[model samples]
Target: MATPSLQDGIDKSGSPIELLWQPNAEPWLPEVVDREFTGWRQEQAAWHEGVALLNLSHHMFDMWIEGPDATRVLADHGVNNFEKFAIGQAKQYVPVTRDGNIVTDGILAREGENKYLLSGIPAAQHWVQYHAEKGGYDVAFETDPSSAFRPGGGDPKLFRYQIQGPLAAELVQRAFGGPLPETKFFHFTAVTLNGRPLRALRHGMAGQAGFEFIGDWEHAAYVHETFLKVGEPLGLVQVGARAYATPSVESGWIPSPVPGIYTDPELADYRAWLPLFGIEGKRPLNGSYFSADIEDYYVSPFELGYGKLIHFGHDFVGRDALLAAKGSETLRKKVTLVLDPFDVRRVIGEDQDPGFVLSYARHRVESGDGLVGVTMQAASIDPVGSVLALSLVDAEHATPGTEVTVVWGEHPGSGAASEADLGFPRIRATVQAAPFNEHARTLYRRDR
Candidate 1:
């Protein structure tokens, strides 16, 4: 029997928007680990003051791409500069549609000779795999779906753990019993802890100096235990799923954007290859920013503050269109919105959600001038002590401290004016610079 594809599901749903705007079984992070170890608030502060252990083994999808033409397959699809990508380095790989609309972004690391691993959401993997198969590239892929979609309840192929915060380096060195290797920002080095081989990527999701340790599943327990024991005195707290969702809120990374794959006639074949059960086929498009046109939800990479990653020197998918979009005044600028405290008391009450539903809703952001932007992901960050919302708005309103309003209720059918219903109806907000953490914005990217 032929496997159901995204195209089949969309056909039955009537439109791509209908296929996308349905209930989803997968929320951002599944409950593989406890939602909290000590308390969400304490876990939230760990990464800021001391160190944090993040169990990322279950939530993200990983795809291993290898073979003679692996690099070619990536170069033909991604907008990142290949000349600078070397073994032990990584990039925030951004893939786009032929029209230059963003498909999604993933962390792509060059792990071996002519081999790479792309990790994060499934959107980029699906896109790259389809193109590779169609182009007949001499490349192969082995996928490890996030625990939510992994078949059977068996163990994952790899285990990923991240030690983050200002004191992450101290924790890592102490655990390793030696001075850590000199690693550049976004670069990784092979290291052995308790005689088990692992790759430690210098990454900072919290916008702090940190290391993401990736290794074989067999050695996962050893690494976890070693870190827990070694990091106890240093005030390391294990971050649960509850607090895990808030890191990106302060880091300025927008994790989800509607991929621009659906509704494009040119991508019909691509859609047919996408599984009906995959994230692309079934993820819910909740929130107030709605249009019958699926294209309305599509975002350009430039709009999400990824213009620097687009390498014009390379000819790839969406190159010509992106070249045209480079300086266009219509592109939206991503910013941080600090929800008003007075309105919080009046609307949703004092106990704002601590990222319980981070990227689920697409709330509408407006100004007195009229509709200006859309809030992508929002959460109550303890460190910031504000309900920070990541939004994309007009250039004119992108400045810090610009007053705006957020309609806090979900529209009935997720359409613009479907209906009004929620705990809170409206809340006022102020535009601010993204990466609300100064270290994240300035010093986090530096390799000291």
Candidate 2:
């Protein structure tokens, strides 16, 4: 077990940046699963024109909070308004530091009056669990870390499956042998399939109509095998771990933003609680953006699209600081950078496989005379035929059709000589809506 603590890790590295900038940082892909099913590119295209069945059972961790104070415990730390958070509805839960910088975000669903399931990256769960324990809240917390860290290294507590793409609804309806509930976005309902009940939430990746089903882990194998049998003929392709990471590029959600837990005196106790090998201490960084002060890498929720989700009607942990940052002219706006196809051919080369080029890649986004933004999660979608990178740039540079240049490559002195062999490549890109795909931006949640 990688023992010690995050504080010790940081102390040994001399600084947080030094600890994070490891040589050839590993891609943040799910463990215990094939990187591809049919092929990542084909799997990606399936979600665009046909249907994609993503096996999410192995990746995300889960936390169960139940008790009289469960709701209040979450309400105090979360930015999303909880007054009307209904029993079966889910929201994009965001928590920020005392200074209002984002800690992390996750999908929080209210399962009962005093029962909730908070699941996603471990950073957010750890933050909430730490507070729940220390604050004397009347809540019982249970964690089911992803299979990656589960003690037995067996099945997880729950199984998550997502059906998405153009024919998603039709395929699922066919499987049900009837009509699906006219569920709104982020809303879930108990649906029966093969005499089994599961929670089906209306959501998607890469901005398409989809449903994500969650249920006991015991049902995973049967449900998956049954779905694959029934869905294959309907153009349903199974998406694997490698291709699953690209959805954020098209869906516009930034995965694994550096948690705002380090360097905050308020979070000193948290660092002490975190293990050195845990996600926070071990999550490495790549890309062109490098700063000695790790705080420079931190971002606010406003920089991302979550600004619209923030509610001020009730007080929360970072309420005062967040209140002050509201509508600050300096905050960067999230945008998608469509890397030039020609430049991609020249720099990445014709033989470069698009489906596998992933990292904590941060490319510098420059607007003519000055640096305006940083690009993250650059990906080459099979359907889009061009590499699209989600970036946060100055508001003026965020307008669609604005031209910018991305200095593509990893940070200097951080890795293998092959990375250097790729050479310093600059590619031209255009600024567009955070979701580069039109379907995601216009029609995804339009019905809601």
Candidate 3:
């Protein structure tokens, strides 16, 4: 018999949004290896000044889609235009509901003529597989679930690592023992490292020049150790999970959003198909932006600042809805919230207050009288001398100097009752450009 999912025993009597905040709920990334190898502060510095290497083989899952109709299946389900997606190129794959609400976004790469790899959150992958099986596509899929899902699932099919910083290219050149191949942003090339085949993708999480090196699991240790040996003089710091999450704020990448797949009548069948223990079923919505209607939580790609990736040239799911929403006057825009330095200190200083704690994840952002938006990720990038958060706000309030208030405490019914009972704390914040780091906006996509 299949093991009952975490949601099997959940009390479904309340609104779906409320059930998400139950104290017993597990985090979306439950098996996150949260630790700082060289310390988080230093790791943050490494990404800016030197080079930072991150081990991404465990936390995120990977799905392989291959067969003659692989590209067709992807083009049908994703909002991105696959017509020009070359084999060596990768793009951010965004899957949406028929109503144009974003389901989830992840990294998709075409490995060969009929082979593709999708890596990131499991929710999007599951959606793709369901369609592939039911749509009668001539495609096959193999998934390497995350460690949290299959504790002893054995060695992963691939080992993933990211190296990013000003010196990243130099380190790669030295490791390859020659000039590094010229690769465009989001494109990759094959190279040999220590006599082993390695595919290096020109990508970066921190919005700096970098490469993502991936290969068979067997070569993981060899590749990591070799890079460390060669990178010793280049100030290479191995980033841990804690620091690994900080870049999203600096790079303007929204890491977590409640997958907008629930409450749509048309998607009832898809919801039924998802395992209760899967990411979609168990992920919680804990921020202060509470709403009885689940639709209030749904977001479109354009609202998330992915308008450039949307193409209406071909018909696809949610194409019509996106077309109508494109350039709409009420469209939400992404921005960075520079939290008031003094107010931030107050929240951290309140540690002496009994049962007081501040949450840095998915806090609610509001204007004077109403909730205008919510923050997706927050971090203290000390090197930048300000606590930063990424937010999607009403266009009118998204100006670089617009002021807003961020609810800093947990919801009243979320997590532990004692912690939840404490009223929400408010912090002053000012809206800024989404890519808070100037280098990310200007130099991020420039080819070396």
Candidate 4:
């Protein structure tokens, strides 16, 4: 398929918010503030040229959860306790169905003592509503469907830029004047750039030590331009969504509208919010498909690599179900698969390409009568000597050295051209532990 493109234009009558797009660039909102100094499209182009700068257009959301029982309200959901989350601290987790199926993965922030910001898939709103109804808590919510990161009211829109990699910090510090000496991972400190107040967070979705800056749209152009001055000097090129998504997969972060293993009413609500949240659309982008039947899409927490994070101490959604099934019934397990180097090379049609093979939800041809379990996310051509993938497999299939077939290429030939065809590659592989790229990620952030 040809590269998707949308032109930048102003929407004066439809909504007060203004948007800009280039015929050749990925669709963006709030307008491209600075064409010369900082263009998200230019940043995307840099990724193909060796360096990477990702726009992160869909992975983010802006929302607010309010009401007196807000804290208790969220607790009733699958979110970990909010009490431990100090003001300005961010927590990430997946919202599970009453049946314990994964509904949506979200990031929550405590903006006020009684109010919180929940951003991720719009399906998260259903979980919030379900909690309010069941817990009888007077809670409310506002979904910022467009993940625009606007700070302060005067600015109609917001723009954020993330600079990552080994030299990301130095380049960012140069743009802000002096150095951003005191920012910690997942923590933010406010600063003024080009006469506009901005918040800089030492956050990296790409698993690299990086910085994300948030500010109003009016000042986006100036802010973007300023970054280029520092970025160009430091050889920091703009990366695209593809480059950034690599780390997310390697880290086992599933995209929104996570499929669940069990069926439930929450599935309908989840479907309603899919388009609003930007997870599933008319044209599917990734390997996962949207299922109207919740049963076909249930995801056990174990399958999501959250088995260790599940604490049964407090009363929360799916608490009883999860606990009751703990001892007796068997729960699904999530495991990683390491592909043969030869097969990996053939799959992407690249000889010794450093880029990893992205995981997809489509059925994978494996070995034996046992079918390949749901492959949630994958990253190939890893620096860690193998192509890795995360999969939710049956109890028998979840084990180290479990001989599994990856199905690299279809029927006859197992080469680059055959792998690129619409059909399966069908390469043989084996099941291992969770987190295929944990080692490499740890190496990247050794300092922090």
Candidate 5:
């Protein structure tokens, strides 16, 4: 097993992923995005043709919560209901402070009936202990180093590599020597690689068919080496953090760290553990990337396009608050808008303006004015030739073809700017409809 590094910094030496994401004094050049993308495409193709693996250590959080009342403990602090989460199924929710600030949202996987694995950051553990004491659940939780891939519980780190595209399964089948048809989405099963028991989950963060493998500290190097050996012929390259940026963006996943969005005096308690949630050292907690003229940057479930998933029939942490504000007047609606690519390119270059590129779709409104929904995560899915933005607006405007205006740019005086001398660059955009790209992802079933 490789010796884990010190806890203060990311595993710079142990994991190549750290090197890939760093722009300077790193293996790849600072201009990697513009120059190396072509080669990255070649590698992506090779890996698709064979097998590709990624050390997901940088992007994961390891927390182990133990107690007789662990399950009950999680139920109290979560903004959403937890009863619906089945064993082995991943449940997502936001942990809120007493003041209603979103601390950080994360996934809880049912590891055992009595115990749960809350993956995201130490924030989950903090909240678990907080409510466990309040609710008298008798649960004790802490960040477990053993939860990491190495022994002695050194640095609680693990790696995740996405095997994607249409050929993902075939490549896995080739390496593991079996049919890959049995795995179900969000379901994980264990397998052995180089004598190490690796856990593979059939969840695709890329929005394509893919799997994520988890293991203890010893398997990282072997896994990385093995993936390269097996994937070379098929076309695989170690995808850097910059290259992975578009995939994360295209996946429409919400980002935790941003200015004027989650950071605020309201979220002071939540901001303490931003590092575990991958948002630390970025900037102020209650600021925003968009300036004053772009509309409110906050979001509710309605604007995040998850209204269908929000059930008010049961009591939840936020049930009373959500119910008190019920009706079209209360709920914000979410929308998917198709943006023009020409506008997005202007935001990417060195000489270009430091600006926001329609991060996520959301609506603007306040209580009692009816639902002025907000948007969540938005992406520019190049495969579909459209800039996709997800927004939450009043339910009345949720329908397709509803025209909405999107504003992008950095506010001049906002905390996002490192120096006071820096000027903000903002832009205005028009958006329309959901499913901005028709090529939604789905699991492949040949028999069906």
Candidate 6:
């Protein structure tokens, strides 16, 4: 069977939110290069011990926006400030609905005066493309979807590789045969590797010192092999998708959120313009936090811990809503919830039972009688010795020691089981700091 493209599966009979949670639908899985290379345990340990090379070329979609009005178009549509966004600088690109809810976010890299590269989150790319086409912006866009999901398993426009850890800098230095360039966080610089020029972005997903190397797709093999040859003596381990996902849990970055464009009647035109088989239609929402009203699923930048990225210096889509949310007493803060060891053990133990499945789906979080928040990403990191989840909770329950309950197990309505039997398992959880790993917070971005 041929693989489905982003526009192949459209169910316009219902809202996008409703379609995502449709009963008996297939569970959503991220497109990855390889599920596992060595093993998740050893790959997870590589980031802390020596170094890990992660192949990011297959999972993310890359979009290039170039022209005179690219910056203006982005500023008008997104919530981020581009005043100081220099040629080589990059930032967490965030776009929101008119009501100030998050549409989608990803990494935005300014390649030149009128050239920008936006990678990740296809929804965000579509949103940008929609606005640029109709908003009368003098911008042209070229989108390159992930290789795994793209037709015919073709090569991507660029091959992205991340080398991260305590020794990542040393490896880069050795690869270049000299000192590494002075690149600040979220910044990129040009470098020569094997006589081929490439751009190195000073960024790390695992909360460690690292550089993301990006160049023409043709150089992918040479660049990858060169790193392996130079990094063999330094104990470099190639990471797989299994371990690549664990870092986000420790770093407190929420990977997925329901796009906010569903419920708003004002966005009906945009919805109609979108193809049927895109991320909105295909991505399934599983977990314990099932809601009839789609608005309940909407999240603001403040709730996602992106308050620092919002600046009122420029007029943008969600500026007013964000301004009001900033000063409001009712603020939802993002925090890490540490699952009780015993509860975790119970969930794991249940896996042995017949007809039972263990899911890492986001669950509903409760404080007392009220549903305070919802957990986003959950994972078990062996190094941390605890199963951690990223959650957005009310300010009252955002403290480190505040106790809460995470409703684990898949709900029957979520299509994991028949409707007659709903298996709702409540697990004890304690609220902790956002970044569960202290090293990720303190040393990830430090200059060595």
Return the top candidate by lDDT.
Answer: 1
TM-score of each: 0.95, 0.95, 0.92, 0.71, 0.68, 0.91
- Candidate 3 vs candidate 4: the TM-score winner is 3
Per-residue CA lDDT of model 4 for 1-448, tens digit only, reads 5322111111121211112111122222223232222343344334322233444433455667888988887777763755566776666655666676666777676767888877655556655765576568987877555434333323334466777665665666677777875765666677898678987767654355666777767877787777777676666676544444455555556663343412244444443333322333221222322222335445666666666556677778777766666643366676777777776766655655534344443335355744546566555433455666666677777778997865432122122221233455555678877654554346544543
lDDT scores of the candidates, listed in order? 0.85, 0.83, 0.79, 0.55, 0.48, 0.79
**What TM-score does candidate 1 get on C-alpha atoms?**
0.95
User: What CA root-mean-square deviation does each model show from the true structure?
Assistant: 2.3, 2.7, 3.4, 9.6, 9.0, 3.7
> Candidate 6 residues 1-448, lDDT tens each?
6544322333433444446664334433346567667777788888877899999888899999999999999899888889989999999999988888898788999999999999996888999999888888999999898865687777899999999988998898889998776888889899888788899998776577789999999999999999999999999899877678778877877777778877676776777777656777667776777765667778888888788788789998878888877856676888989888777777755533111122346578887656888888777776666678888888888989999998775554433422222456778999999877787777766752
Runs of candidate 2 with Cα error greater than 4 angstroms are: 350-355, 413-423
* Local lDDT at 79 for model 5: 60
How would the candidate models be sorted by lDDT, starting from the highest?
Answer: 1, 2, 3, 6, 4, 5
What is candidate 2's lDDT per residue for 1-448, written digit by digit as tens? 4579998889898888778876456787777878888998899988888999998888888998899998888888888889888999999899888888888899999999999999998788888888988999999988898888888788888899999998998889888897688898899899988888899999877887799998998888888987888797897899889888888998898987888888988788889898898888888877766556788678899998888788888878888988999999999999988888888887786545433566557667887756788876787776778888998898888899999998776665434432233455688998889777777888878765
Model 6, residue 367: C-alpha shift (Å) = 2.7
**Could you tell me the TM-score of candidate 6?**
0.91
| Residue-pair clashes per candidate | 1, 0, 0, 23, 41, 6
lDDT assessment of candidate 3: 0.79
Model 4 lDDT at residue 349: 51
Q: Compared with the true structure, what per-residue lDDT tens digits does model 3 show for residues 289-380?
A: 55556677788899888888987888788899999888898878899999887787777555332121213355678787677888877777
Q: What is the lDDT for 439 in model 4?
A: 48
Q: Write the per-residue lDDT of candidate 1 for residues 1-448, one digit (tens) a residue.
A: 9999999999998888777774322355577988889888798888888899999999899999999999988989999899878888989999999899999999999988889999998999999999999999999999989988889877889999999888898999899998678888888889999789999888787677788999999999989999999999998899999889887878898988899999789999999988999878877786666667788889999998899899989889999999998889999998999997767666666455433344557778888737788888887777776678999999999999899998876455544444333443677899988877777888868663
Q: What stretches of model 6 exceed 4 Å from their correct place? A: 1-13, 22-32, 351-360, 414-423, 443-448
Clashing pairs in 3: none
How does residue 315 of candidate 3 score in lDDT?
79
Q: Which ten residues in a row have the lowest lDDT in candidate 2?
A: 413-422
Q: Which parts of model 3 are misplaced by more than 4 Å?
A: 1-13, 23-34, 351-360, 414-423
